[model samples]
Target: MLSATDIEVSLAGTPVLKGVSFHAQAGHVTAIVGPNGSGKTTLLRAMTGDLPYRGTVRLGEADIAAIPGWQLAAQRAVLPQASRIAFPFTVLEIVRLGMMASAEPPPERRASEALARVGLAGFEGRFYQELSGGEQQRAQLARVLTQVWDPVGPEGPRWLFLDEPVSSLDIAHQLDVMDLLGDYAARGGGVIAVMHDLNLTAMYADAVAMLAGGRTMAQGAPSVVLTDTTLSAAYGCDLRVNAAPDAPATYLLPHMARRAG
Candidate 1:
């Protein structure tokens, strides 16, 4: 299990998160949802040890901060909201960077397999800077995929922590990436993503944590936390959640929101 308790984070002497607690079981896709400046990214960064906090975060039975950096990289890979490259690197070179932490060199096929998984099959020789925004995002995802190739390692179940992973993708690629994440979770891995798309979160996440005013307003199954009342309160808008008879997942209808005044 991955768990955080009483997590408080401050940036530049300003408090961002106030006593936030969250937990996710293995083999599940857990989504963190909140409005702008609601501390979603801050909380995720803290959990991944990219940011410092005054709370306890445990991955399985060990504290995350205490784990060695290489061991941590072996167990989990992170995909940030944005990535920039100064040097012009080939897609294959970028993907191969993921395995730099290992003692032995990684085989060429591993990188190729990761690229294919992200729909970049033969783009290995393409320049990273020349790809479109969505393609770059997919390439970055492929890099992380190669890092933790096996969802479950001998140490334990590995993890993927992504921040707005599909933010740059089109609808088709968005669904494809979400399906891949779902498949990873189904294979006993853990996925915790900071998501802005409520409908996607409802469809893909096994659990949802809603944040408002730097605190977690609700955390549970999407059906329980994605209600009209909770969503409206968190986003400060008159939002509605609807289910369609033809579809299996719930969808958000932002157009149905009325002026609150």
Candidate 2:
């Protein structure tokens, strides 16, 4: 549903990404995972078309840049890591704003449904700034959810980009958000997420793109990408990756930090 071909980026004359290319399929969850400074955030921005990037990015049949800004909002909904509003707006107000760029109606009824989807139903009238970080993240997810559902008509596929979506949440909330992502993909929406939790990615993502030093080191099924060699190289520590006995994927164990912690 979404792809980047030989894409590269630089900030202040220093390259941050070097010839990255990958595709996110429809009805599947794809995750970008790496250590700090691995260009995860840069890649997410490149996907969103907010930053200048070399090479081609295609969202379904049309070039990503060719899509009009207003139209692009309907084609894709983004929940960036920096989804904070300085102005004092109600949670519902912020959610409706996400649909403003959309071509659909003010998503009021849809907003409540979206809030409930993320388990934040009664928080409609709460101030955006008053909520905790995890609550705010769910609020942002509610906004994106409205956009996704709003564009579910003839538009067909809608792309969802999430950058470190679980950074603020406790374990339960993190799982809550991940489950929502899986549900979105299962419903035939395309999901591309930037995640730091390898275990979460393993549990949720159908495919994994391992990025390091601003380049894609590997991209494929979770078991292939989250290997011992790749994890050690990317993280500068010894690690082990083993299959989960109860599941179909691998689980990463950081032996070094496991001992330290």
* Each prediction's number of clashing residue pairs: 0, 0
- After superposition, the stretches of candidate 1 with alpha carbons farther than 4 Å from their true spots are 255-261
lDDT of 2 by residue, 162-238 (tens): 99888889999899989988988888888899999998998899999999998899999887888899889988888
Worst lDDT window (10 residues) for model 2?
A: 147-156
- Candidate 1 per-residue C-alpha lDDT over 68-167 given as tens digits, one digit per residue, 9 for 90 to 100: 9999998999999999989999999999999886556678799999999989999999999999999999999999998888889889999999999999
Model 2 misplacement above 4 A: 150-152, 256-261
lDDT at 225 for candidate 2?
A: 87
Q: What are the root-mean-square deviations of the candidates from the true structure over C-alphas?
A: 1.5, 2.0
What's the lDDT for residue 62 in model 2?
86
Best by TM-score: 1
Q: What is the TM-score of each candidate against the true structure?
A: 0.97, 0.94
